[model samples]
Target: MRIMAKTDVFIKARIIKGYSQRELAKKSGLSHAYISLLERSVKSVGPATAKKLSDLLGKELEDLFRIELL
Candidate 1:
């Protein structure tokens, strides 16, 4: 099964909030590299990290990430 990467929504939310990856990292207290990986869909975010990012982005976790199978 292939899992869908919903990082695009995360990216759009960050952009809408006028935050760069570095800025988001600072706000979310996550490393910039990790945020970069998240944006690139190269890494899956954990629940804790997802919560932090969703809070920072002013979005719900459900709106940020969607899981699918293929």
Candidate 2:
């Protein structure tokens, strides 16, 4: 998946779950700056950090990535 798409999904999911970037950062044990960068797609996060976000959002890591329907 493209980094931007992945970031978008992550942010969308967080919003759907009623979390602000600051709240998500707290829950995910990440910095607010890092969370902002991730949500804005300004930085490409490594797998571990991505997994932490996924876990905090109660979503699977695979769901954050864009998947081909075929």
TM-score leader: 1
For candidate 1, the 10 contiguous residues with the lowest summed lDDT are 1-10
Expressed as tens digits, the lDDT of each residue in 1-70 for candidate 1 is 3222377798899999999999999988889998888777787776777777888889988888765454
After TM-score superposition, the amount by which residue 31's alpha carbon in candidate 1 deviates from its true location, in angstroms, is 1.1
lDDT of 2 at 18: 98
TM-score of candidate 1 against the unseen true structure:
0.81
TM-score of each: 0.81, 0.74
Residue 49 lDDT (model 1): 74
Those runs of model 1 whose alpha carbons end farther than 4 Å from true positions after fitting are 1-5, 68-70
Q: How close to the true structure is residue 70 of candidate 1, measured as C-alpha lDDT?
A: 40
Candidate 1 RMSD to the real structure: 2.8
TM-score of decoy 2:
0.74
For every model shown, the clashing-pair count is: 0, 0
